[model samples]
Target: MVDQDIFDRLLQFRPSGAPVLSVYVGVDGGPSALRTKLESLVGEVLEQAEAEPSQALRRSLLSDVARVLDLAARGGPPEGSTVGIFACHRAGLYEEVVVPRRARDRAVVDATPYLRPLLAFLDESRRYCLVVLDRMQACLYELFMGELEGATIVVTPGKPGRPVGRDPSPAHRLFRETADVADEFIHATRAELLLVGGPEETVAAFLPFVPHHLRGRVAGTFAFDPRTMGPEQARCCAEAVVDRYERAEEASLVAEILDRVTTGGLGAAGIPWCLAAVNEEAVQFLLIDEEARASGSACDACGWLGLVGATCQRCGGPLRVTQDVIEEMGAAVIGASGRVEHVQAPTPLSQHSVAAFLRFDVPHSAAQVVG
Candidate 1:
């Protein structure tokens, strides 16, 4: 699983003398078939890079790729549907990230590994707490990317002889304890959305006990038998709510980007201008179309980004061409602490394909970078 710590480590890595090979592919097959597919992909990579410019670099890259395949062959099939392999032998970096979501099938060999998609997926994935409550007990569960992470159960104290309506009775104390446990979980994880489920009566009674600040983050409530409900069912319910929230957020983001571009305030549209802004470290927000694709070059020596150039305009370093320029740009944006949003299909941004919000304007004489 790609956790937060692993993601942060990848972001901090820098180009050490040799280029890194980053590969992402969908291996959603049975054990035997997955191994076969990975082997085939390795073979394709070797053949495709046969005519690469640097023979020594190509040899080292293929060797690392083969080592990655060997490790995959030795291990059991991955639980996640997709896998990401980042290898840089010189830098002593080799990691296999298995994630539940699907990723594009592509390979990039650059001074630094390409990790935009992996980071983007992690950024978009939300963690939620599903609190299943009943009169007797309240169960607090942590769910990440639709998977049951961990859970805790706090049972209501019982005063067998006390009257139920009394303020100090077990019934009142039980509700109080349940609310306290929920509050602790909220504070620990800083979770925004809460999925409350139980008998209708218990759920209704429980909401009033929740802290006032957390009440607004309650996405919705559902009915479930606490005695019979399991983790899988709870995860499914939470995922449904998260999906709806994500969709609405994506729509709103697209609208805002379009609006910014129209007003010509902080936003920029078109590939050349966006790339130029990226070169200048002026982009604050990157908007990428779902189907956006471009080929461009980056110079490691001076960190110059452009399309027409085969060499760095600043330091005269040779340009490294990338097949997926959008991915490269996404990685760069994140490296500089900028946020990115993937505009989904059937959107107005499709015509421009790429856009961004810049921190400052580019002078006309400095905007264009000639080859």
Candidate 2:
């Protein structure tokens, strides 16, 4: 029997679009005492409402609530006796929302009429969840909401340069780097189904490291052709591997965006030269890759040197190319500010290539390109 307050919290639970949500559920005196009280509360609620709840409904609700409370109770010291139920939901208003079962903090709230339909949708669709493993490396994994199916989970095996066993061989290094690369890919994309192929030994060594929660989601595995394999291959393979999962279309769209950035298309040189032609005020964000960032040089036409330098190295003329480039571009659009960011190239592709995320309403064109 859940406490009235706890039940009410669950019913009224609403989360903002913030990055995370924390929830707390209060339980009765002790575990044994709380369980006894829950039973009594359930009986009383049913009797007072004059509604005979089905066994399945009663059991499911009680079990989920109990799980939440138990998790909360695991906190040490100040929260030892008390339990909490915490869950993370997408940050948005949606018609239907499905809460995860393993959430630690839980609170009961009024069961709104709209909640039924939303819960139903979540149950049917089984929204996938993103799992980030390494913050620095940006390795990610995706998993179905419910059961783990036949999913190919990609992982990076072994430390950066350390050998896993007695022998140090080129094959071993390749194996380690490949696994590291795969892990990095997963961390970045957070894809649920990982498409991977390599030596049988490598596969065996890597599989054991996958988290237990993700074990059930393994879709299937295949012997990958390692000869032609590279970053592009991995991307394509990941797309193919997770085909059965939800949001495949969305994943493809993201892959396409990545592809554009990987090539020179998003590079400073690749972006239309005309982007510089737009009014300077319109520019908002100025994304620059580490490799693509260049110091101000003399204008081709005017031979004028720009900021950070004393004078036009080539011509004695007073240099004019400094902050004006950024200012000129930013003026074309609405009220806009400017920033410079550095990016890394996607692996197994052009090492020299980079990407910039320009924020402005104007379309990309040759005339808009600026220095």
Q: Pick the candidate with the highest lDDT.
A: 1
Instruction: List residue ranges in candidate 2 displaced over 4 A.
Output: 1-185, 199-205, 209-218, 229-238, 244-371
Whole-structure CA lDDT of model 2:
0.35
The Cα RMSD of model 2 versus the native structure comes to 22.1
Candidate 2: clashing residue pairs, number: 67
TM-score for each predicted model, relative to the true structure: 0.80, 0.21
Q: Write the per-residue lDDT of candidate 2 for residues 1-371, one digit (tens) a residue.
A: 12444433433443232212222323435556555544443343334223424554444344444443344245331222223333322332111122322222232222211122222222223223322222112222344433233333323443556665664554444444444555554556464444333444555654554455555654444344444444344434443444433333333433443565456343232323324312323333333222332233334333222334445434554443332232222222212334322222232212322222334334445332232
lDDT of each: 0.73, 0.35
Every model: Cα RMSD to truth: 4.0, 22.1
Candidate 1 weakest lDDT stretch, 10 residues: 362-371
